[model samples]
Target: MTGDAAAVAAERVAGVAGELAARVTAYDALRDHRAVFAYTYFRLTSDLAAGLRTNNPPFRAPEWVADLSVSLAAAYFAAMDAIDTWLGPVPDARPGGEVLSADLPETVPEPWRDVYAASTVRHSYVLEEVLFSMMAHMSYDLPLALRALAARGDVHHRIADFHRMNSLLASSVDVVQAEIATRYCRRLRSLDRLFVRDDELFTSYGIRVARGLAWFNCDRLLDPDASAEALGSISRSTAAFIAEFRSPDDWRRRRAFQVLRALVPSRRQWPAPAAPVAVGSSPG
Candidate 1:
């Protein structure tokens, strides 16, 4: 892509990120736990937009990275919209009628369904919600975004830019964590001090590993010989990964409990879900 094209794409990314930031602020006002991941994502997207606008962008192919970022963001928003629709009251139903099951629509990706369900559960911690959102986005949405980009043109040359995204993601962690601490979970600040260096290290490492797997899966997706089967396998693996995170026997859950125990007095408190805003109601 030409420099001008890259600039256009970067602007689009910035626009999307700005819209997401607005949504995060609104979610925060509602004391919605979804803001945990939404805020983190907004920071990451904001950073990417900034990087793309830099005179000497870190990405070798700025346009490709910008496009992929926008695509991924679109996927996230689509899934969230689907969740809202799925969870909303059934249209024109009689009073006290049986509502639809909690299952998301078939159009909603499986991994995201799990994340939405987990986020709504009472007493779930911030870190678990964050991790589940990350897993769903990275494991399920990313490969599909990559494949879409690949279908348009060769993405082999853009591999470096894809890997470079990890650094961009890492740089935003401290700021994201601090903001989440201030806005959503006060205990996150205390938890950060308890783990300190290990907290960031583990978070960054897990992101790198997940993104690396995403790229590997992208390769599998692009393979002409197995693309059909690869798609099914990717979906299955993503579902299983999320299920493991939801499992009681999972080490991550056990560790989260230990962290919860260590910070006994500072248990995470979630606010009640806000009443739905009336249509045409302007945000205060």
Candidate 2:
């Protein structure tokens, strides 16, 4: 492709990736405290995997693995649906200001809009396969690791402090005008550390995003004469951040793209429909 055409493609990719990032990042931020946490979490991860897997190799994920992955994502979505039934919408349109609605390629703040935008692009599918779906599945899997700690009750009791936490978060945002003004840069840095991976998958993921941004970012800091150098720097920084935060745990080196590996049963086999009962359950 011509340099200009390639540049345009990169810009488009960046926009898509940015939207996906926004959704994923937003869900993660809200998942712990908001009523919408479950919904946002599943939706965002499902969408992310959908996008990432397209570039994934064949047989990297088998049928059973794929099915379970999709199911895990749906479970989170279902959990969100349940929350909506009992509680209510988590309020995507927070009261902070107009920062989220601002145009992209510019104006969009660092982490919030950027992450949500990434989630959106990841979910946009062309056919039967969805890259984000896998991500959504993986996202659900992350919390599932803690399910043993939460099995005492259903969603609400499991996430008992949600409302309080969300309330605190909401109040914090209102103190400022725009999201940028309100955003805790410390929080962003902290979370980036939490999810970033230096391994192959994460490295590739970061590179892809950086490449997308390089193609799209028209920031004055990236003049054509220095664009290559700038892109290299950005890519390295992203990779470094991602590597610093991630673990060998999420990389899936154990199973080689086996989706089931991400799915940890509460206390049984893969895709266990029901939770295992304790050896000493009372007689009916």
Query: What TM-score would each prediction reach against the true structure?
Result: 0.77, 0.23
Assess the local accuracy of residue 259 in candidate 2 as a C-alpha lDDT between 0 and 100.
34
Model 1's TM-score against the true structure: 0.77
Which parts of model 1 are misplaced by more than 4 Å? 1-6, 89-102, 189-202, 246-284
Ten consecutive residues with minimal summed lDDT in candidate 2? Answer: 122-131
Q: Write model 2 residue lDDT over 29-82, tens digit each, in one string.
A: 453222122222323333333322332212221222233234343444443344
**Per-residue CA lDDT of candidate 1, range 54-148, in tens?**
62355667777778988898999998777656655443431222222245677778777667666655445676667777877887799889989
Decoy 2 TM-score against native: 0.23
